[model samples]
Target: MKIAFLYDAVYPYEKGGAQKRIWELARRLADDHDVHLYGMHYWDGPAVIEREGVTLHGVCEPRELYVDGRRSIPQAIAFALRVLPPLLREDFDVVDCQEFPYFPCFSGKLHELVRGSTLVITWYEVWDDYWYEYLGRKGLFGKAVERATLRLADTIVPISEYIAADLRELGRTAGLEVVENGVDFERLQEIPAADADWDVIYVGRLSEHKNVDLLLEAIATATTQLDRDLSCGIIGDGPEREQLEADAADLGVEDQVEFLGFVEADADVIGNIKATSVFVLPSIREGFPNTILEANACGVPSIVVDHAENGSTAVVEDGVTGFITEVSSEAIADRIVDCLTDDDLLADLSAGAKAFGRDHDWNVIVDELEEVYSSVVQRER
Candidate 1:
């Protein structure tokens, strides 16, 4: 089957959970199918190139994905306009478009209508009420766009039950398939642990939704509670880095926290995760966090906050693979202390985490996605 994926940012070039998901699925599916990805050109030289058996089309020149720590509307609109022409020229069995930055889904829909291909919209999150928080009064526009996008595709794949539930509440019932995010278990197993170790680590973009500031506060509290030095490594760069660094200094945990900004290699990221005793994802909002599974695959337990919007809690087996605490610095601190001081508990959680990772391997996820594509194409035929 020939498959096409649409998103503004490409993987490895622009690091994010959704980008990684598309890259992993596209590359693996390319082994047996004709897979193509259309996105902003983060690479130089040519608009089209082949990498790892998948064809990548640079739909437009790369634009700043974020402006003032939020997704740039202009950038999304630019990609949406540029992507339509290329999409209209090609025909594929499945064209899967990421749901966020909603404009491009219309392009995929247009292509589906023109080429008679099955269009699939993969939803990471359904920002209904949250749209208000994200955009204030203007969020009504965002909400309307989201609702309209839901009806564009016959097949809508939500990455978690949390997202699926939201989609249902928003009047989407038919063709809603819950396909969870996954980890690269085999690749993680091969990478050796980094030489340096940390008491705790957080790997992801430092954005407002991520709540890295809360992690800084927790690290400070954990240091005070532990008495001895407690080191926390923050791996990943984003808009909030400077503010987060300042927050760490204000909390007097600057020495205790190290910001290792965005390690390029997947092996290095996994290696660092392996070296950590505990992985912390304090984000209050998440569709499906790929970092949790990645850490679990590295035999490191994760600590996630129990927030209604945080769908990552689904993958975590509370008290077994990891602990889920309320969305508070104090609560997170307590979990950090528990994982760091209690050697027996950490070992048990680590074992449980590895098992959890194995269960959600990317290979299994890809097989499920392949079935969805095939079923959609068959039904369309």
Candidate 2:
């Protein structure tokens, strides 16, 4: 079968959960079927190139994904416009488009209408009420766009059940299939652990919704409660890095926290995770966090916050792979202390975490995606 994936950003070029998912699925599917990717050109060469047997077509020049700590509307519009012409020229069995930014999905719909291809929108998060939190009065426009995009796809593949529930609430009960995010478990096992070991680590963008500030506060409280030196490693860079660093200093945990800004290599990120005793994802909102699976693959149990918008809690088994606490610094600090203080409990969780990670390997995920694509194409026919 011929498959095409549509998204504004490409993996390795721009690191994110959705980008990684498309890259992994596309490359693996390319092993058996013809696969192509469409996105902004983050490279220096031609507009089209081949990597790992998958064809990548750069629809436009790369643009800054964000402005003033929020997603850039102009950039999204630019990609949405540029993508249609290239997409209209090709016809494939399946064209799976990412559902964020909400413009390119319309292009995919147009392509499906003109070219007679199956359109699959890989839906991530459903903002709904959170739109007001993000855009104030202008959220009405965002909400309208989201609702319209929900109807564009022949099939909608949600990354988690939380998102599926959101779609149902918005009256999109039909054609919704849940396919969760995955990790490269085999690749993680090959990378050696980093030399320095951290008592706790957090890997992801330092964005506002990530609640990383809460992580620092939790670390400070945990340090005092433990009555010993606790080292924390933060990997990744974003708008909130400076403020988070300042927060750490103000809390007097600067010495205990090391801000390792954006390690480009996956091996390095996984290596650091492997060296950590515990992983913490304090984010209040998440469609699906690939980092949680990566951390579990490295035998590091994760601590996630229990929030309505945080769909990542589904992937973590509460007492087995990790612990889920309320969205508070004190609750997070308590979980951190629980994992750090008890060696036997930590060891047990580590074993369970690895087992959990093995179950969500990228190979298994791609297999499920292949079935979804085939079913969609057959239904369209």
Candidate 3:
């Protein structure tokens, strides 16, 4: 079978959950099927290259579809217009499109019509009410467009039950499957653990939506209340880096926080996760953070705030894998202090997290995905 994946960003190039998902799926599928990736040239590279049985085709130039961790919808629409000519010329058995930069999927749908290929929309999560939270007044238009896309999808693959619920709420009645994200266990195990220098670590973009300020406040409060040497590693860069740095100083915990900007996933990120006592991400929204899966693979438990829309909280089994805190610094701080101070509880959670990660290996995930792809193809037949 021939499979074509449509997504703008590729992992390690643009660095996000969606990027990682597309990269992982394309490579894994390549071993068994003819796989080709249709994405923007976010990094310096040839227009076409083959690696690990997967062929990558750069449909657009670097920074053409995105800017500063945000999607320019209008540019995305223009990009779709530019992509349509070449995209319609190709034929595949199955075409999987990422839900973001949503306009391009219309072209994929046209490909399905012209070639009789199955069209599958890989939905990480739906931005329902979050449009307002993330974009203030202009979010109304964003929400409308999002719903319109959902209604047009031929098949929707949601990553979590939380996302599945959002689709049902939007009146989507069929062609949906919930496939959880997985970790690269082999890669993580290859790297030796660094010295456990960090008491807590938070990886990912330091954006407003991530609520890194809340993380800083919690780290400060936990350190003050404990009266001991407690330090955190903030790994990743974003628009909020300067403000978060100032937040640490303003809260008088400048010495306790280290902002290590954008370490490569295969290198420093894995080592850091193995070395940390706890992983924390207080984001108000998420589809299922790949970072959490990576932390668990490294035997590091996490403390993530509970957001009903964000299915990431579902991965945390409260006292078992990690604690789920309310959306407040005080609640998060209390849990951090408890985990850092209690060796027995921390050890138990770490063991549990690793066990949980083992259950969702990429091999197992791809097996399920293959089944989905075959089923979709059969339905078309």
Candidate 4:
């Protein structure tokens, strides 16, 4: 099969959920199929190159798509203007486009229809009310555009049931499918464990929707109540860094927290996770976090907030693999303290988390993706 992936950023150069998902699938599928990626050239290398068995076409250079740490809709419009023409001429058995930076989806859908190729829109999550949380009044318009894109695809592939439900609400249940996110167990198993240097760690983008302020407050409260300085390692960079740092200072937890901005090396990132007593992500919204799965693979348990609108709660077994607490600093702080002080509970959760990680290995996920691609192609005929 000839597969084409339309996403404007490549892995490592601009790492995020969509980039990781597309790159992983492309590289692995290239083993038995002709896989090609079309995206903006964020790297300073050749416009066309092959890596990990897949071919990549750097269509255009990335523009300033970020405004105040969030993706600006205007930038997406610019990307679509540049990406559409180059992508229209290409023909493939199937073409999958990331649902974010949504303007390109309209053109990609038209291309697929005109070429008689199977079109699949890969959605990690639906913004829903998060539009208001992130974009204020403009979010309403964003939500409308998002729904329009969701309806344009011949097939919709959401990463979680929670996202699939959102699509259903948008009247897109006919050909919707759920393909869960996964972690690389083979690489994770090779990561050597390190001594616990930090009591807690949080990795990924430090953005508004991530609710990192709540995490800082919880860390401060945990440190004060425990009568001991609780060390925390925060990995990743974003527009929220300065605000988060200010938050830690205001809460008198600056000395207790280490803001390690964006660990670029995978080994270093794995080392930080393994060296922590517990991992936590107080994100107010998520589809299916690969960070949780990665930590689970490292035999590390995590604590996540039970977001009302998203399916982050579905990822954990509540009191087994990880604690799913209410979205509050006090609740999160209590769970963190329990995990740190109670060695028996931590050990049990660690075992459960590791067991869960085995079920969502990358190999298993790739096999499922292959099946989905084949089915979609067959149905297109």
Report the number of the highest-lDDT candidate. Answer: 2
- Give the top-scoring candidate (TM-score): 2
Per-structure clash totals for the candidates? 0, 0, 0, 1
What are the per-residue Cα lDDT tens digits for candidate 3 across 311-359?
7787788998998999999999999999988999999999999998888
Identify the runs in model 1 with alpha carbons over 4 angstroms from their true place. Answer: none
lDDT by residue for model 4 (1-381), tens: 999898877887877767877887788889999999888887677988888888888877787768877787776787777777767777888888889988878768887878878888888877776788767998898888887887787788888887888778867878887788888887899987655598999998988878989999999889877889999999999988999999999999899899999888877888889999899989978888888888998888989998777477778889999999999999999999999889999999999999999998878888988898999998777
Model 4, which residues run further than 4 Å from truth? 194-196
After superposition, the stretches of candidate 2 with alpha carbons farther than 4 Å from their true spots are: none
Q: What is the descending lDDT order?
A: 2, 1, 4, 3
Tell me model 3's lDDT, rounded to 2 decimals.
0.84
TM-score of decoy 4:
0.96
| Model 1 residue 99 distance off true place after TM-score fit, in angstroms | 0.3
Winner on TM-score between 2 and 4 is 2
Predicted candidate 1 versus true structure: per-residue lDDT over 1-381, tens digit per residue: 989999999999988899999999999999999999999998988999999999999998999998988999999999999999888898899999999999999999988888988999999987888889999999999989988999999899999888889888888989988888899898789999898869899999888889888888988888889888788899999888999999988989898899999899988888888889999999888888999989988889999999888887887889999999999999999999999889999999999999989988989999999989989899988
RMSD of 1: 1.1
Model 2, global lDDT? 0.92
TM-score of each: 0.98, 0.99, 0.96, 0.96
The lDDT values for all models are: 0.91, 0.92, 0.84, 0.85
